[model samples]
Target: MTTSTYHGIYAVVSRIPRGKVATYGQVALLANLPGRARLVGYALSALTDPSVPCHRVINAKGEISRRNGGSEADEVQRHRLEVEGVFFDSHGRIPLELFRWRLYADE
Candidate 1:
């Protein structure tokens, strides 16, 4: 992805509010790069900005996707989400139906 695409993904990730989550696909769509969910994940994984809050992006199933680097990254993401008061189900999923951001409808 180009630097612009990476920044676009990060920009969308940064907007995810606390206590809510958005799927990678949602972020991609909102960023105007439909079908780029994996690209979104890639950009988020490369983020160095402490305030980006990339952990707020989950999978379609509301489960944290495997990070680019492996388990350590995934663990860190999960911990960050938990710290933000986002609850996980018994199966370790976030339950998108409950926590997924409804965008304009929510605002």
Candidate 2:
């Protein structure tokens, strides 16, 4: 993807509301980049915007990706989620059935 596309994905991810979570696939799809979930991850991994809340994204299975090279990134994500009152199960996966964002039909 081009730099513009990456910026577009970042914009979409930035719009995700607090206390809600979007999957990597969801952000990609929302940005009109189907099947580019990993691209979304890549974009977010490079994120520097404090307002973006990039940590609110995870895998489709509701598990935060451990792509930052260690458990430290995962711990940081979990800590952020906890700060937002997002409870995780014993397996460290968010219960998407309960906390997943319900995007509007027109969104």
Candidate 3:
């Protein structure tokens, strides 16, 4: 993806409020790049900005996705969410109905 695409993704991601989460597909669509959910994940993985809050973007299943199947980053993301007053259920997934950041009116 171009740097501009990543910038657009970053812009949308930066808007996700504390204690709320958006799915990768949601971020991709909000950034005007439809059907580029994995691209959103890639851009976020590449981002180094502390203000972006990439950890706030979870999977569509409301589960924290692991990088390279590693739990270290997943743990950090979960901890950050917890610190922001977002709770995880016994299944270790965020309840999307409660914590999803829906930008659309009809969603």
Candidate 4:
């Protein structure tokens, strides 16, 4: 992806408030890059900024997308979310309706 594209994704990710999460597709849509959810993931994977809060981005299923057997990173993401007061159900899935950040047209 172009640097501008990744920057757009980063901007959207940065807007995700603490204690809430957004799906990759949601980030793509908000970045005006609809239908490029996977691109959001790719951009996040390449993120080097510690302030971006990439952990707030998850899959559509409200679960962390596996990263080439990187279970440790998965744990870290979960831990961060929990610290922010996001919870996972017994199935290890977040209830998106409750924790997903919503951006209304006015906002």
Say which candidate scores most in TM-score. Answer: 4
Which 10-residue window in model 3 sums to the lowest lDDT?
Answer: 98-107
Question: Residue 72 of candidate 1: its Cα lDDT?
Answer: 89
Count of residue pairs whose backbone atoms collide, per candidate? 0, 0, 0, 0
Q: Using alpha carbons, what is the TM-score of model 2? A: 0.89
Q: Name the runs in model 3 displaced over 4 angstroms.
A: 69-71, 104-107
My TM-score estimates for the predictions, one after another, are: 0.87, 0.89, 0.92, 0.94
Q: How far is candidate 3 from the true structure (C-alpha RMSD, Å)?
A: 2.3
Would you list the rank order by TM-score, best first? 4, 3, 2, 1
- Residue range 1-107, candidate 1, lDDT tens digits: 46988888888877888878999999999999999898887787677888887778888998988844566878887888888888898999997877888887563
Give the C-alpha miss distance for residue 54 in model 3, angstroms: 0.5
Estimate, for each residue in 33-77, the C-alpha lDDT of model 3 and write its tens digit. Answer: 899899998898888989888989999999998888555988988
Point out the higher-scoring one by TM-score: 2 or 3.
Answer: 3
* Whole-model lDDT, model 1: 0.84
- Identify the candidate with maximal lDDT: 4
Q: Each candidate's lDDT (Cα)?
A: 0.84, 0.85, 0.89, 0.91
The residue-by-residue lDDT of candidate 2 on 1-107, one tens digit each, is 57899889988877777788989999899899999898888888787777778999999999988863565878888899889988899998899988887777223
Tens digits of per-residue lDDT, candidate 4, 1-107, equal: 47999999999999888898999999999999999998898889899999899999999999988889655899999999999999999999999989899886213
